[model samples]
Target: MKAVGVIVEYNPFHNGHKYHLDETKRKTNPDCTIAVMSGNFLQRGEPALVSKWARTKMALEAGIDLVIELPYAFATQKAENFANGAISLLSALHCEEVCFGSENGTIDDFTSTVSFMKKNQQAYDHTTRQYLKEGYSYPKSASLAYSSLANHDTYVDLSKPNNILGYHYVKAIHDQKSSLKAETIMRTSAGYHDERFSHESIASATSIRKALFSAERDIKEIQNYLPQSTTKWLSAYFEEYKLFHRWEEYFTLLKYKLLTSSPSELANIYEAEEGIENRLLAFISESTSFQDFMEKIKTKRYTWTRLQRLCVHILTNTTKDQLKKINENPVATYIRLLGMSQKGQRFLNHVKKDVEIPILSKATGFSDDLFTLDQKAAQTYLAIFPEPLRTQLLRQEYAKPPIRFNEEQQIYL
Candidate 1:
């Protein structure tokens, strides 16, 4: 059966996501759709507003056939790495195509940009460093360099959060030389960071998040956009668990790790370059709050977002060597089932023997292939959960309740 894949972070599934899924199905007409999604934490270095299981259920209810967890190591990373991880997973699942949302909605433009970056690697690298030396953030530096090469200001605009990420997705697919076809749907009305939820059909995830936490946000206001299953899951999860409100709790540990570790050790962490270890140590002593710490270390060469991701990597013990190794040997050797429909189960059985990766439904014990970093990351990720919720996470495997998509499916409203 033909299948299409999506890489997503349905932090709290909303109307926009529903539309993307519907459009993807309409365009690809795949026999099934699979989503490789972020778990617990997102690429932005923040805890998900809801649990992975809840988000997986929301996907299944919203028409996704299978939901598999994207390992935290890959999920909370920069654009290139994030795309590499997600695309590798999708390719492993034998997906024939990938559908994503982009503001430009032109596959040709994305391909052109990727091709330019590839062919002019030396010139691009030099220009990028030149821009960094001129006091621009890494994102700005890269943007300026690309813009200079393109002889147009448009490349600079493409550096905006979503477009940069979209470009990375295209690049990853091309670099891997995968058979998966790429298609994009134009993002309408709202931009990624828009704070208002005025758009009736295309409200941004940021706006939905704000509305979800606002005192004035009523069920009626959200009911029109969210599926009943999503609302039900949110209601239950929110009542039992409190989302992370601060990044300060992990500060001391992070500081200790930085100060005690040698430059050689820090060199192993992703994005650790030139004398950044010293700067990281200097800021940790005075800066408070995740945002403040990021600002203090922000150089013209590195954006705040990039620095924040670096900090998260350090805190989580993800080393540069580890990232490099993973990238060099990018493959999804195992699938950790988050949630799936009955049809998904049948589908799993059909591909079980043929799939290259081990498909895991239960999280009882760790396998040899599971790295020390993965285990450590899993432990750190689970530390934020409260009591019974925390304990429940450990034993959740015993009660593997699969979602039944055939009965729970809903069309876009």
Candidate 2:
């Protein structure tokens, strides 16, 4: 069967995602579509609003045939590594095409940008490093470096959020030397970081999340911006967990980690370097919340996303040595199945033997370090919840099998 793949967070599936999925189907026309989604923690260095399984349910209900977990190692990484993990999974799934939502919808522009960068790689590296040394944030340095190279040339703009991610996707495809064709769908209406709703029917997941966390706003106010499947699962999560996740929930623990750990030990955590440990230590007592802590910690040199990622590492206790080993040999060891539709099950059964990598449907008997790290991530996400619920959910995560959606029955199994 022909297959197409999308890299997604689905944080909670919403109308904009529905639009992209529709357009991907319209464009690719694959027999089965798959999503390699982030697990409990996401690329932006934050906990997902709900569990990955709930989000997977959202994906399956929205017509995605298969949903796989992008391993925590990659899902919680920066742009390049994030793209690497997502593309590797799609390749492992034997997908023929990979599509992403981007500010620049034209695939050729991304290809052109990739080709130009490859040709001038040495110069690009030099410029990026020099700018980094001069105190520019990584993303800013990249944009400035690209401008210096593409001086008079028209290419994909590296400044826009989606476009930058799209460029990384294309670059990963070429870097991995995979045959999967890359495609893009132009992002509509809401922007990636917009904290407020922009359209009546479509909104960025960020905006939807902001509303969900607002004191005055509630889930019902944002119902129109999500699919029924999204609304249903979100309500279900609230009903069961009695809370939705936000950074503020983890603030106290973060403060404890920083204040308690020695500066030397803090430096061992991935992304906690260059004396950031000291700054984090200095602010721990004075900071009132995660927002306040981040405001105090953030500078032109350190982006909010970067700092949050560092916090995630601290929360999970993931070390630089651990991550460095993985980065050096960054092949996806296995693809963990989160959930699947009937079609997805069939597709997997058909392709499992021919696929190059292991397809992990359950983690009960397994013992891979990467998977263990993912397990740690899930536990950390659930750690904030009280007593029996936390214990129950953690048990359920390992003991349960990959979710199966019965199209005919119109129910989850």
Candidate 3:
């Protein structure tokens, strides 16, 4: 069976995500749709508003045929690593195509940019270094360098969240030279960082999250744009647990880890480079809040988001060695099933014999690699939430309902 893959956080299933899913099917008409999703943490260095299982159920109900966890190590990383991890998973799953939402919807433009970067490596490198020396953040430096070389201001807009992510996705596909085809759907309505909601059919996940968490919107109102199963799962889940509030609950443990671990040990954490270990130590000593610690350590060379991810890596014990090894063998080796429908189950059966990666349905206490790391992170991540919420997360998997799509539901575009 032909399968198309999507790399998503879903953070909460909203109309925009539904549109992407529909568009992917319309373009590719793959028999199965697979999603490699972030676990409990997201790429932006924040805890997911809902648990991964809940998000997974939401995806399954909305249209995704299968959901695989993007290990916490990659989920809480910068765009390059995040794209690498997600693309690796799709490639491993033997997906034939990948469809993503982009501000610049044309694949030709993305491929052109990729080709330019590949062929002008030296100019890109020199310009990047010069920009950095002039006190720009790495992302801004790279964007400026690329724009200068291409004579196209488009690359400079990489500061925008979706555009930057799309650029990385294109880069990863080009770097890997994979057979999988890449496609994009035009972004509509709400922008990625926009804190407000739009009246259009497509709504940003940010707006959805805000609405779900605020008293201004009721659950029933939010339900209008989400799949029924998502509404069901979230309604049940929210009743039991409050979403994450402050970042300080994890700060004590993070400080303890930073203080207790040797500088040599800190050197091993992902993104730890060129005496960053000492800088982290200094920040840990003086800074109290998570935001303060990030501000104290942030430099022109490093973005605040990137530094936040590094802190998460340290907190999660994702070492530089681990990052390097994973990069070397980037293919995802396992599928940690979050949720699936009956059709999805049948699709799973068809692919089971030929799948390169081991498929995990139950979170057995046995694995020791990335899967184990994911489980540990999920357990520890829950501790930051309030009382019964923590308890609910610990016990969620045992009682959480799986998503089941109706047979009569429209599958074709």
lDDT of 2: 0.90
lDDT of 2 by residue, 160-245 (tens): 88888889889988989999999999999999999887689999999899889988977788899999989999999999878899
Q: What is the TM-score of each candidate against the true structure?
A: 0.86, 0.98, 0.85
Q: lDDT of model 3 at residue 371? A: 68
TM-score-based ranking, best first?
A: 2, 1, 3
TM-score of 3: 0.85
lDDT of each: 0.74, 0.90, 0.76
Candidate 1, residues 1-413: lDDT per residue as tens digits? Answer: 78888889987787888888999999889887889998766787766776677788789888888898887767877787788888877877777898888877777777777777788889989999998788777778877888778733334146566667778888888878888888877777778778887766667777777787677885557766677777888878766665422355456667777778877787778877777877887777787665587778877677666676777777777877677777676655677787766666666776777778777676555553333555566555566666776667756633454444563444321
Q: Single out the weakest 10-residue window by summed lDDT for candidate 3.
A: 404-413
The candidate that wins on lDDT is 2
lDDT of 2 at 37: 95
- Judged by TM-score, which candidate is best? 2
Clashes of 2: 0
